[model samples]
Target: MLPPILRLLATPLPLPLVQGMAQASLTHILREHPGLFDRLGTFAARPIAISPTDAPFDFTLVLARRSVRVTRRGATPPAYATRICGPIVLLLALAEGRLDGDAEFFGRHISIEGDMETALALRNAAESIPLDFVRDLAPPWRWAQRPGQAVLGAVRRSLLEREGVPCN
Candidate 1:
């Protein structure tokens, strides 16, 4: 289970509020470091749409103007598809040259749709940005914060425990 604080943070907020927050955050980052996303170039103009299949959950992230749609379904080839969740994370990892791309992290459980090549291209483009620098762009309450690491660790432990696997 997620901690109360995290649950609150992740709670569904009004769409306007969510959009405002995202825009504000992005704007801040861009203003603070104009070159941060320069490498992204056209990719930043693209939009990535994420939707949870079999559910009403859906969102979109416009990168450089390209649109990549991601969706989650009970049974599908690309189970969890979203540029934010999959491509973004993967790109970040790749950019840092730490791309484990572990099946455990993004397994058959998630799927990618539309412009697989573009997604791959974005991954290559992200190579210019350092992961640490990217992490530095978020706010304190952001998931990139230390608390988020703790939460991820707890979740990993819980998953391992449930699977009867010893967690380190």
Candidate 2:
């Protein structure tokens, strides 16, 4: 189970607020890593549905266009070329390259459906980046970035420890 803070922040929040935040997050990430999409090659155009099993919503990732569409669970979602479902913590760890994708997949911690190639391509693209979710996702300001990183890093380390993964 996710921590109460995460549940409280995500579960009852308004959908549009969550979606707008998600979209802005994608934009911020792309701005920080300009080559992220280009690294995906032709697979960048493919739509990938990222479903966080523990979250209240799913994210349809549009890497080519540097956009993300957030949809509430149980709602009709847009068509995607592939779907990847996992716990939100694991998914975030995977995106940050903190966990190996193959190990998780083989261990059944994550499930993938639809196009296998697209999934692989997406995984490769994510692994290629050295992403510090704390620093990357935080506002791009000198003062805020450092404090944000410190707090988020501690939170992430706690989460990973609970998941039995050592935080570097």
Best by TM-score: 2
**Which numbered prediction scores highest in lDDT against the true structure?**
2
Q: 56-92 in candidate 1: lDDT tens per residue?
A: 2245656543222322233232322234333333333
TM-score of 2: 0.93
Give Cα distance to truth, residue 28, candidate 1, Å.
2.9
In candidate 2, which residue ranges exceed 4 Å CA deviation?
A: none
Lowest summed lDDT across 10 adjacent residues in model 2 is found at 1-10
Report, for every candidate in turn, its global Cα lDDT versus the true structure.
Answer: 0.46, 0.86
Candidate 1 is scored at a TM of 0.47
Tens-digit per-residue lDDT, 1-168, candidate 2: 467678778888898898898998888887888777767888989899999888889899888888899898899888999999998889989988888999999999999999999999888888887777887787678878878888888988999888887688
